[model samples]
Target: MNDLEEVAGLLAKPEPSEEVVARSRSRLQHRALGHGARGHRTLGHRMRSPGRVRWFVPGVALVAAGAAAAVVIATGAVTNAGAPAPVSGKEVLLMAAVSAERTPQSSGTYWHVTATWLDSEIPPMESWTSRDGKRWTRNEPGDTSDTVVPASISLRLKGADVSFDDLEKLPTDPEALKAWIVQRKGNPDDMSTSEIQGDPTLTLLTLITELPTPADVRSAAFRALAATPGVENTGAVEGGQALRMPDPDGLGEEIKMVVDPETARVVRANLLLTADGSSGSSDGDIAVTTDWTDELPATPKDRP
Candidate 1:
């Protein structure tokens, strides 16, 4: 089996309200919820799934039976590996420490950030942070956190602090994944690759397929963590050397993420509904190639 076929196994693995639910479930039809044909021009905003009732994501591959198990992860790169595996009592202390360090007495962790994508028409470069999932702060920080600057958008996950495998374990819609599933032109069902290069390690997944759409990319990534095995933040699946699982419904797409294991932070990701059966690459005007290679910006002011 291919590497992803391998990762698919152990690696585990939303949407919105009703008016939102209608928006969330529209992935299959690839239509718009409240917008028109012109409004739906970009798949990023319109493609949302309705399964999780909290978010939407990308494509998936039902894993083949007993494909392969046992995956060896690189060191100090898979989440808290630098320290001894926590039991229960100590775990609490570690978590509390992590939280206190990032959270100020009455303020948040605000990091100056600059984001971009292949779509040059991106919003703008500005400051954005969220203290609790509900409120958003823009450019200038103040006492309150219920504002937006349009020019900037912060990266925050609303539901739970889910991991990669979480995507597969969660029940999310399938439509959104399609938009991010890229397999070259005319080779829809073909496979791709995801290469991760981080400090002290370099991990690569072959036949890399599946990703989350822009609309709900954040939640979709957590779903992926749900299913990851042999790793922390592995939502539903257990940890191990390697794992291979079946998609059943391509639910694997939900858990799409490329994170900095040590920092427990995200570096990059692609969520789109796809697998070994679809074809054609979404490129040109409708398609995009967003390349993200940036140092982890300072911790966001409002971190979880």
Candidate 2:
């Protein structure tokens, strides 16, 4: 089996979250009840996921998976016996950028993304966007039917709305890309009391994983993330390495991502509430899959 396939199996174990955060099912249950009473909804459904952690929408949820016990990492590029060398967190991001740069340009009739919330109470969401971002097909959560609508659902980077053409023209150099992100993020100083501060890490992660940017642009994003402060490779885990970043919101939460370096794919990303971070019980999380596909589901007969 390939490396990512092997990592997927390792991820099936139930160890990572234990070391990360003690899950409080009771708190989740209580919050869920509160959501129901308040008529909270996931997009259009009545089931709520988690509050916006300043990085995502209220209905979006992060991904989750199991992790193994932390182990000593490799100190160099390779061992004397030729065994694979363990890499640092920064190294992992750099390597992922290389891999992303080597990816061939591709296209299909539709751009697909599947975002599965870690919370079991919420249903997964599937969406397909037309190449020009003028049409969309979405499988609504808790609804068996799928519908194609004449609506625009563009990919968002930071707070800027971008189309496929716009993504294609993004700067591929790390410095230029960083500047672009900062510009799109807007100035937080001008915001009122309700606006949340921007998290550059989250925006970079979204660019690399979710946006359909060119391979070189994606590589630049990875390189930018490697240089970001507080982004650390924690240690070895079962499926892959675990990388942690300080919670930008200062809400007593830490951001953790399990990534398979081989395929440059982020297996899961979660927000763990540290013991001293916050009294809140919700875990703001997001796991997403984005790709190009040719298959198009049927649309309503009456609507074009």
Candidate 3:
């Protein structure tokens, strides 16, 4: 099982209070995901074995410092009052978020599509790999135990985890974002070769680091966002607008997350990472298409 599934296992323990179970059921109903804090691994994990060849898995990088710097620089060079540019930041961002490939599919009353959440700007993260790691199986569409994750570096996937680091604690604050920047200082440009589309709303925090046991970049989020301002009430950001929870990421990774805008709770989250390179190229030409709706039953077999 993967970290999320494992986490599910933890919460699934016989003690899940009626309220907790109800809450989990509620998320499936309304579909809310909160945004906030957001991660990496290292050498030994980097170099491949004597006979194993290294393959470049897509997505996964800590872009907080660089991304935050980009934000601060953009905000600093702009006007604080009066009518601003017609390309209002809000419009630019909203346009970025809602744009996607597949619209929600409807089968009578049920709509089925992937869900993703946005809070503010997101943080950076990396993946890891390890021998003892059992490919924490999140098993997304087209994914399998053999899925390439640059494992030689000991990197992890977004929903995967290790004993030392828990994926559920991803952080989301300026200080933690800043600290992440420091931690990933050496990788300022270790980014993998990939590009994102300009018009689509991409979830920018999906990352890959290390190369063994698998890790989810978002796993490091909660702790980072614990001290963040504004997001506490869900209405403090963007002049009364909630913006998306766990907003953008410091790294440039872009994957969408869907959460109940009001409650910051996750209903469903999409994990496909788009590439910036040529879309028509073989293997690179693929674009993720997802959809979700309520009427469907919540049985284990009916899930996407």
Candidate 4:
């Protein structure tokens, strides 16, 4: 089982009530993600392990974030009053939340994803899952044939195993969304990637990246991340803004994501070390593409 699948197994317990989750949120807000926060592995770290390699279900292009950032900057029209107001990282996230709320919803037969590693030999991958999240298929690197994914499998979101429908049904209000994720995430001790388990920032980022998530729910996730303490707007990169979250563990590793403020889409996500000045390469960096489509690829049985 992949890390997500392994984590999904631990969620058999009943979901916590709203009241219970609310209390949990209060504690989560106060506690930073690092500082002994368990299971805090990078996305690439988990994806590269011997047997666990899968494109992040709802991933995005690595350079897209940079290009999107450039767009955000190029269109910075000065206000009638003065220079465009300085925006905080929190403000940027909040703005993304608003944009997400305004996004129109879409549906189709399959939730499709394609991804490639930034600077590695990992082959590009394509995946398709039924809208309901029951059936799945994948095109492996260099393989002419399609592989059927087990119907029993599902992606992880906010610490729970969820179908596309479940994603659509997630709470739209920020506080409620936070409560819901924390409740499902349960204890960090049982999770494989400790980086996200107790960390509200990473949890919400994961929600934003997942496919088939309702627009408003994605907005809620952004708002929750913006509300978290210690998030910073580290200035403009290319055309987009860089929003950096706190590093509680003092591991010297920093996590930053680029967002296309215009569309409320996260263009890039990176896990970097403070001393690693070189941006030209990182094994864990990847480009992810996600969408919905009705045309499914023919399986081997349908092929000649």
TM-score of each: 0.25, 0.63, 0.25, 0.62
Give me the displacement of residue 57 in model 4, in angstroms: 20
**What order do you get sorting by lDDT, best first?**
2, 4, 3, 1
Candidate lDDT scores, in order, read 0.23, 0.51, 0.24, 0.49
* Tens-place lDDT digits, model 3, residues 1-304: 3212221332225344444444433332222123222222111122121211122224321111111100111111123462111212222122122211111212222212221122312221112222233221121212232232322222222212223233234333424433443333122122322211111112123321111101222222222332233222222222112223332333332222222222112222233331110011011211222222323233334446
User: Which residue segments of model 1 deviate by more than 4 Å?
Assistant: 1-48, 51-115, 118-127, 130-254, 272-304
Report the Cα lDDT for residue 50, model 2.
Answer: 29
Residue 226: error of model 1 in Å?
6.5
Highest TM-score, which number?
Answer: 2
Which window of ten consecutive residues has the lowest lDDT sum in model 1? 195-204
lDDT of 3: 0.24
* Best model number under lDDT: 2
- Candidate 2 clashes: the total is 8
lDDT of 2 by residue, 23-68 (tens): 2222322332332232112332221112232322454432211000
Candidate 2 overall Cα lDDT vs. reference? 0.51
What would the per-residue lDDT of candidate 1 be over residues 1-304, giving only the tens digit for each residue? 3221222221222112233222322231232211112101122322112211111113211111000012222211122343322111111112222322232222233323322222434232223333221212232222123334332222211111322233334332222322222211221122222211110000011112221112123233323322233232222112222122222224353222333222222332232221111111111111212222222233355345
What is the RMSD, in Å, between candidate 4 and the native fold over all Cα? 14.2
Candidate 3, residue 110: how far the Cα is off, in Å: 30
lDDT of 4 at 248: 40
